[model samples]
Every structure is written in C-alpha cells, then in structure tokens.
Target: MGTINELLVNIEQYRLLGYAAVFLLSFLESLAFVGTVVPGALFVVFAGSLAAKGFFDLGDLFWFAAAGAILGDGVSFRLGRRSTIYFSETNRLFKPSRLARGQEFFARYGGASVLFGRFNGLIRAVVPFVAGVAGMAAGRFYLWNVSGAVAWAASHLVAGYLLGTAWRTVEVWTTRFGALLAALVLVILGVYLLKRFFVRRGRLLLAFAGSLLGSVGEAIITNPDVRTFVAAHPRLCAFLAQRFDRQRFAGLPLTLLGVSFLYVLLLLGGVIEDLLASDPIVAVDTRLDNLLFAFREPTMVKLFLWVSQLGRGTIVVAVALTVCGILALWRRQRYILPFLVTLGGSTATALLGKVAFQRPRPAGVAVYREWSYSFPSGHAVIATALYGFVVYLLWRRTAQWGQRLNIFFAGLVLMLALGFSRLYLGVHFLSDVLGGYLLGLLWLIIGVSFAEWRRAEWGPVSAAVPFRSRAAGAVLLVGLLAFFIRTGMRALPAILPANGAAAATVTVPAAAIAEGLSRNRLPPYTESIAGDKQQPLSLVVAAGNEGALTAALRSGGWLPVEPVSFTTVARAAWQALGGGFPPVAPVAPAFWAGRPNDFGFARPLALAGGKPGREEARFWRTPLRTNGAAVYVGVAERIVGYEWGLFPRLGADLDRARDDLVRSLAGSGVVAVSRKIALSPPMTGETLAGTPFFSDGAAWFVEIRP
Candidate 1:
C-alpha cells in the first residue's frame, strides 16, 4: 500500500509528462503506414486507466487523444494529395493494390467509410489517404475525420476505465487464471498457424510424397519374391485393388470412413472400460476437479455458464430447425436428413451411456447440483455433432482454402471450450467429455459418408442460391438467434449456484490435531496446481482471531506482505534492481491443498558484506478449527540471496527459519504454549519456485493467549 501511495504521488508530480506521452502515441498511430506499427489505441486506453486511478483528468485525455489523431490524419491526407510516389507496387508498407482496395471501399461508402474505417486496424491508415487522392473536399474530409477521431478516442478510453474499475475484483485470481488463459491462447494460436501452413504448402508436400511412394512401389513390384507372392494370390490382390479404387463410391472413400468409424468406436469403448475398472484416468478426474474448483471465481463461473448454454437442448434444436429450413430453401435437400440423423444419434448415444454407467455427478465440488448421471457429457456430444456438421457444410460451400481452414478451427475451438466448461463447472469428468467427443465423432463420420454417397448418386448441388432463397435463410437464422437468447436468459439462473449457498466450515477437537497430522487427514505439505508436493508445513498456530495472530507477528518485527498487483510488482522490481529490499515485499503465491496462501509476512535479514535478505512465511486458514479458535498451517523459508536480480534465492536450512520464527513469537510474550512435534518424516524437497531446502519435518504448534 505504501508503494502504491508513492506511485500516486510521483504520477501527480509528473502529470504533464503523462499527457505528452499519450498525445505522441496517438499522433504516431494516425499517420499513414506508421499507424500500422504504432499501438496508439492501446496507449490511450492505458491513459484512461490512469485517469480512473485519479492521476489524470479523463476529459483532458480525451481532448489530447482526439486532437493528436485529427492532426495526424490531416498530415497524412496532405501527403496523399501531394503525390502518389510513396505508394508503388514494390513498396511493401504501402502497396498499390492495398491503396486500390482502400479507394474501392471509400467509393462504395463515401464519407461514412472514414468513420467506420477508423475502428478497423487494417484500413484505418489507408482510407484517409485514399480519400485525399480521390479529391474529396477538405471540408467534408475534416468533418468525417474529426468525428471519427473523437468517437475512437472516447470508446477506447471508456473501455480502459471499465477495465480499471474491475481490476480489484480480477486481481485476486490473476496469477492462476492468467496462466490458464495464456495456455489456452497459445494452443489456439498454434492450431491456427499450423492450419495456415498446411493450407499453403499441403499440395506440394503431398505431390512429393506421391512420387516417392510411386518409386518404392515400382521397385517392390519388380522384385522376384514380390512377383511370386502376387502370382500366388491373384484374387487377394484383386480384392485389395478394388477396395482402393478412388473412382467408385464404395471404394477408397468408404474404406477411409469405415476405418475412422472403427477407430472412434474403439476409443469410446476404452474410456468406458477405464471407468469400470477404475484406472488412472479416474484419479486424474478427481485431481482436475479439485484444481478447477480451487481456481473458481464468480466472474469465471458466470462466463463458463454462458458458454455451456450453447450446447443446451433448446438451443441445439432451434439451430437444427433453422438449418433445415435454410437447406430446404436452397434446394440442398440431401443434407437435411443426414444432419438430423447425426444430431439425434449423438444425443441418444450420450443418454444411453449415462444409463449404462450410472455414474454420479462429482461430489462437493460442483457449482450447482446436476441430478443426471455423469458418465458422458451431453453438452460435449451436442457441441461436437452439431457444430462439426455445420463447419463441414460451410467448408464444402466455401471456395477459398483460408476460409475453409478458419471455419474448421473455429468449430474446433468451440467444441474444446464446451468440453472445458463442463469440467470447470464440475458436472463432468475428463474421461466423460472425451467419451462424448468420440461418440459424436463416430456418428458424424457415418452421417458425412451417407451424405457423400447421396451426393454422388444425385449429382452436384445447384450452381448458385437465388436471392429470394438467401433472404429467407437469413430471416430464419435471425429467428434462431432470438430464440436462443431468450431461452439462455431463462436458464442461466437455474445453472448458477444459489445466492444463499456459503462455504461449509469443519471444526476438529484440539486434541485431534496431532492425530490428524499423523494420519494425513490434514495436508502434510503445500501442493502445486497439479497436486505435486512443494514445501512442507513447518508452522501451525492456534489463535483466538486473526487480529491477535497479526498483532503477535507484528510484535516479532514481521510485516504483512502487500498483495501482488502491477504497482507492488513494479516497486519490488525497482527495489530489487537497486539492491535494497523492503520488509513487506510482495511474495510469490504458494498453494496448500487446492488454494493459495491467505496471509504472508516477512522480516528483513542482514547478510554478510551488507547484502540484503529476508525470512518469509506463508499461511493458509484451514477449515478445521479447534475449540472455537482458528488454526493456520504455514511454511517458512529464508531468502539467502537473489536470482536474476529479481527472484529470491532460498536458504538450504528450512528448519532454522521455522525455529527463528517460533523463538521470535515466544519472545513477544503472546504465546501461551509452544512445542515442536514431529509431523512427517524428515525430507528434502524443492519449492514451487525451484528453490531447494531441507527440513526435520517437525512443526511448532503455538497457542496464542486469549
């Protein structure tokens, strides 16, 4: 908190510099070609966030941003009016074809293009130059440009302000949630990039493989041993050749689909078998359930609930009906039956699996009660079958490979999200979702094969869909969307947890603490998100309340660590780089059971040669209390040095840190009784931060006087 105060004071002292920076970024962002490289909008949004913090005036930021943008566009327009020299076929930044496209867009929309293009990153710079080259009147151009800049500035700043307001609510879960979000983003980006590479180079690679295979085949067929084998089995060879004939519907296409169907069927069976036999997959299910439950926040809960609704029965039925109507109007009658069959088959398969397994929904971790059996997720099944078919249809109709790849990846993302939502909500296990996907894919293969055969028999679809048919399809799509919105709104309340529900607390007798520790009823060590052991619990304190515990620690020269945030983190970085460390520096989080530490404290340590160090402890308020007093489980470690001038390096002796903290508390005159008890077998381990330490596995159980 002191660091935040200092930061605010510094910002106030340099307010003019902040405004100047915002203006410069906005100005550079509006210049043609340069705008493409400048993140002007991002800077303005950050300035708005600062305004929310009360360091800058929101109104002043808006005016500066707007003025900068206006002046920048005016300069770009003037350059365009002077010459076309900058825009040539050879210039990568300002290509002739790109300018031509911008001109075409400007011609189509007139002055309105300026207003709309300001929001589009690709054309925001090009449109204004195109307008000037087309001889648009200066008065008209400035009118549109000023209006666009003002609107753009206002929208970005307001968004940033809203983000700032919500930062407090978001900060608590930022570390864990940020890691999850980053992983998801990387996976999506990798898939998209891979698809692009395939779309661009797939044919050349396939042609090369074909030539290599042809040469190998020629060599094999000419060998005397192979010729003898083929002569000995002419009928077998003929059968194999017939099955691989690509020209016939019952040949290679059917063979490939049949193999895919069998593969998916086997995978689905394996999941079911694993569940029945209680394999390692079931253990994974429990661990993931606890991990996601620990990371749950209200905002994320609501988000996943909204996404889960996309797979609901009402929404799927509405979409199916709408697509059927669309296909009927467009004269694609063959697809309607196959689509319905795929959706219906997937739904039925999910229901049957639920009945066959009779697996109960996850206990204790679910956000809301789900009465249905949980062997296979219905949401996952419907998402795969319905969305997968829709993407396939779109891919067939689209002419561009890029568009087709995009459609495929979009469908993949949606399906994966639906599956994750089920797991996050604790309504389905990992294996259940996987089983659902396999079943859905199996049915989809069958449906697509049937559709393909029908198309081969009936002939290709009509060359074009008429305008009337297209209009009718659009109206039906709009109706479907409206129905979905209304139904989802009604269902959201039922899916979310009740407002009255609170976390349940457990109380244990004080005498049982020793027994609990011995039997491992209480966790013996801190864990990572994946349930790997980190540091051992070496401190256990019983206090009448949090106030008494905090007072005792403060009296022992320990200060509470500040919460991790942008301000505190920046302050820590600055202090670390300058070779001075504060007593209340923000500590990296550690998890116990499934949740992060509830409290952290540190005392500055003097090292040899005037080096800086500290002793830190993190504690969690356990659910088990004794005799109406709160019980805290904690781990203590000494920071002996620094790593990379940022991260703290831990001392090798964990026992010394624990003993020092106990002695300090005893000397504070707040301890009623303190004793060391062996909690677990002595061991050496590494912390989550990769710092190695050894402990005697004994903990000081201190009781604070009431």
Candidate 2:
C-alpha cells in the first residue's frame, strides 16, 4: 500500500506521461503471466485519485486504463489460442490440471465469466487465456472483455476520486470555518438522501441481500458431502423439516422450511454461546449498555419504565386472561391453548434458566431492583412470549400479508423494547436479555407449531369473528385501559415522593427515626432503584427547601450537572474522547419514589498524574420534610477511566468526599449538625463493575444552616 501511494505521488508530477503510465500498468496487470507480477489494480485506483485532484481528466484516465486492460487480455487470449505450439505440454503455465479448472470455470459461468472475472484478482489473468483455449469465439471474447475492462476502470477510478475529494474537503475544513460548516451541511444532506433512498427501496434492498445469502446457503446445502450425509440420515432430515417448517400443515417447501429452522438455530446458538463461553458478546453487551446509558434522559427513562411494567406480573396476567376469555367465548375453546402454552411455558422456562445459569445482573447505579437470580431476564421472556402469541393469533385471523407483517413487526418491536428496558434499568446483562428472548421465542414457536399441527389434522376453523363481536373486542380494549391505569397511577408515588400528605405515606422503618446516632467506616450502598448492585447513599440534606440544598452544594464548589439530555451527553462524550473529564458527566440513574434523581452535582479532582477523576453525587428530592425542612437523599460515586478500555467506572470509592464536604461546610462558617442514619439492612455487595464493598447501611444527614 505504501509503495502504491508513492507510485501515485510520482505519477501526479507528470500529467500526460502519467496517463500513459497508467495504461501500461493496467495492460500488464491484465496479462496472463505479467498480471501476476504487477500491482495494476492499485495503480488504476491511484490514477483516479490523481484525476480527482485535477491533475488529469477522469474520463481520459478511465478510457486509457480500460483500453490497456483490453489489449493485455487480447494478447493472453491469442497466447491461449496457440498454446499447443507456443508452449510445451510440460510447461507449468499450461499444465493440463490448471487448464482443466479454468475450462470448468468458463463452462460454469459461460461468456459472463469473461466480464465478471475482471473484478476478481486471480481470475482476471487466467479467464481470458482459458476462454481462448476452450474455443471461445473472438467476437464473444471481445464483447465481454471490453465491457469488463470498462466496468473495472470506472469502479476503481470513481472510488479513488471520491476518496481524494473527501481528503481535499477535510484539508480545507481544518482552517476554514465556513468550509467546515459547508462540509457538515453536505454530509447531513448526503445522509438524508441515502436514508430516503433506502426507505424507498428497502424491500428491493432486502430481497437482493436475501438472495445473495440464499445463493451461498444453497451452495452449502447442495454440496456433495452434505447431500450424502442427509441421504444417509433420512430421519434426521425429516425431523428438521418438521421442526423448522412454519407452514408444514400447508405443505411449505422443504428449502424454505430448512432455512427458517437454520435461522432460529443460529440465533439460539449465539445466545447459548455467550452464556457458556466468555465470548465477545459479553464485551459487545457492555459497550451497548454504556452507549445506551449515554443517551439517558427523563423522557426515555419514563417511557422504558412504563414499557417494562407491561411485562410486570399484573399486566401480563390481565392481558393473558382477557385474550383467553375472548377466545373461549367467541371462538373455539381450543384456541386458548396457544395463549396458555406461550405464557406458562415462557415463565417456567425463564425461572428454570435463572436457577440453572445463576448469572448475576450487571452492576450499575439504577432506579429499579429485582431479587430474583438474573441469568435470563424474566421481563424479556414474558414480553416475547405474551406479545409473540398475540402476533400469532393476529396472523392466523388476518388474510392480508401486509397486515400480518405489520402485526409481526409490532410484536417484535415491543418485545425488543421490553428487553432493552431491562438493560437500561441496569438489572440485566446483554446475554441475559438475549437468552430470555431466545427462550421465549423457542416456546412461542413450539406453541404455534402445536396449534398449526392440530389445525391441519382437524381442518381450519374460523376464529376471525372476535373482531366483529363488539362484546369480545370490548374486553380487550378495557383490559388494555386497565394496564394504562395501573402503570400511570403507580408512576408518581414511585418516581416523585414529594412533600405534604404523600410524604407521610411512605413506609420508613421504625428504627429509621430512632433517637440515636450510629457511625460506621462505610455507609450502606443504596440499593439500585433497578436493583442490580449497591452503592452508597452518601449524602442527605435536611434543608429549608430545594433551593437551599442547591445553594449549599454550589457554595461548597460543586457544579450542578445538567439532566442527561442529548446535547449534554454529546458534549460529555466528545470531551471524554479527548481525555478531558467533564465535571458534570452523566450519572447512571438510581430511583427513589420510582423517579430518577432530581439533580446531579460533581467536583473535579486534581491528581498529580494519570487520568483525573470526579467526585459526583446524585440526589432525589423526597416529599418528606423534617422540622419544616425539605429532605433530599443522595448517593455519591467517583468516575475514573478503565486501565485497558475507553469505558469509565462509576464505582470508584471516594469516601473522602464526606470529609471534604464537612471541611468545606465548616470552612464556610456554616454550623451544621451531622447525623448517621442506616439506609438499608446490613450486607456486603458489589458494584456493577464488580467492585466489592461492605457497608454498615449508613448515610450522612446534615442539617444546613440558613
């Protein structure tokens, strides 16, 4: 590559001579023996790059390279036509076996091989020669040969030209602000157009990609060895055919059936591999978690929180019962079987997987907590099973392919959303969610297969009347409304436990208000709202109001952090990439009152060397008040970069932040009383990053002076 770049640089110095040089190089590159010794392809692309720089005309460069390639292949073809006399039978280049392979390739692809072979490295040299030896007509060779040469020339030249254009643009943007803006605008416009193009031709693009994959798959399936193995194991083939065929009852083709089964197996195998092996999937999951965490904001948090609740025990039960009742009343009673099998099977399987794998959840600061073992996320499992069954039922009743596709994708979106909710909430790892999805899908497939098989034997029954029956439809509508009501009504108390009557309603432990003080070396880590790992609820303020708490932290040299919105996140990411630690970095959410932290504050640390760190605290404004003062609960954590990777850890112990805060407050001459309070039952736990910690369940309570 370096040598090719140097060659291109030298060519740029000589204008007309450079075009001649490209023609010569491309000619030799296309010749039978000479092509193997020359780097013709790179030279052609380089010539194009130079043309883009305005050193030569792109059209002239293309025609010259293409003409060179044509002439080179013409020579190779004539050599092949006279091979018997020009070369010995023992000559390595004209060996019978090598010639036979080329003959076979030419036979398989026909004249089209002459055109397509130009793009392929080794084939470019041999195809023309072999075609001549195989008695291809001169007219036919010339037709494909010229066409292939033109295509090859145009492709490389255009690619190199575009790259050169981009390089020039970047060079200008470095010193010119206006040019930079222009470039950015162009990029945005290009992206918009590309997106529109894909959207308009999405089906065509998908079909093309699918066909390419299908071709490769067909080759593998039809291999002599594979055919022999299948022929010898007829039962195995039959079993796979039945398992994979979605429309087996309707006599779906064996190829389609096998493809469907293979796809499912691929997904299932991937999830299982991540669990059984310390695979790259784990790294991918962590990176995804970090990236998504970067996009945390109040709206998304609320949205996912609500969506995750759809898989909650109450909502799932209601939906399952409503759908089953409607089927039992207005349709065949046997239709209820799919609903039962999906829901029950998924739930049981997920539970068993949890016990069998015993995998722990990813440790992070979070807003929700679950006590169950976290191998396969129960939420992911339930959502896939329940919603998937709904899609199945909708598919059975719907006649239109478009409507069926819509229903299937909607269900898929919901299931994926629920699974993501588990990750965002910090209660499950990527593998766990993937495992749940696979497990749920497996169960749904089985249920649907059974339902389809039974229907095939008994003949199809009409179950489409539920849509026409207002009474049955009403049940589904009301059930859905109940789900909204349950989640909405439950949101505030869980998220925003504000002062006044609501404040008094919270169930604080009797010992919490005990008139005593307890001091431990370590404070108990607040249980993650999403309940993954434990971290210290390091600070509490008994201030006159929210404004007072804000003023106190600000006066103590802590800067208030912006809520995790898009702009703030982008800035933080940009700064982090440059090794600059933003003081107000985004905080992983921890829930109190079922709501995210109301505000975050951080102070930059000064280290003698190495990457700097930040001491950050996140606070929740509770509705509770003490002696006419508003109460705020806060957890503190520190951030430092990983030694090996770009991701930073939020589990850094900054216990000294407590002493520092005390000194800062005392330095301000603001007399405040400090009290130690127990926040949770005593236990030893780890952070999401696997940092082990033991806390005596203590939090600091500071009564601030006005």
Q: What TM-score does structure 1 among the candidates reach?
A: 0.67
Compose the digit string of candidate 1's lDDT tens values, residues 1-706.
1224466688789999888888888887887766765668878998887786667899999999999999888887887787655666664466777677778888889988888888987778788888888788999999999999999999999888766644422332333344456657877997887776657544434554565568897898899998899999999978877787789878888898999999888878878887888765765677677657655666667778888888877888888888889989999889999998899898998999899889998877788778899988888888788888998888878888778888898899999999999998888888888888888898899889988899889888876999999999999988987887788777774544423244455776666676655555677888764456777899989888778789989988888987654566667768988898888877766777666777889999998999999999988877666777888889888988876575577899999999999999989888887888777789998776556788888888888888
Let me know the TM-score candidate 2 reaches against the reference structure. 0.44
RMSD of each: 15.5, 16.8
Highest TM-score model number: 1
Q: What is the lDDT of candidate 1?
A: 0.80
TM, every model = 0.67, 0.44
Expressed as tens digits, the lDDT of each residue in 141-213 for candidate 2 is: 9999999998999999998887665454332112112322354456556555544444443444465456556
lDDT of each: 0.80, 0.67
Residue 222 in candidate 1, Cα distance off native in Å? 4.7
List where candidate 1 sits over 4 angstroms from the true fold. 1-188, 205-224, 273-281, 494-512, 518-520, 545-616, 621-623, 638-652, 689-691
Deviation from native of the Cα of residue 114 in model 2, angstroms: 23
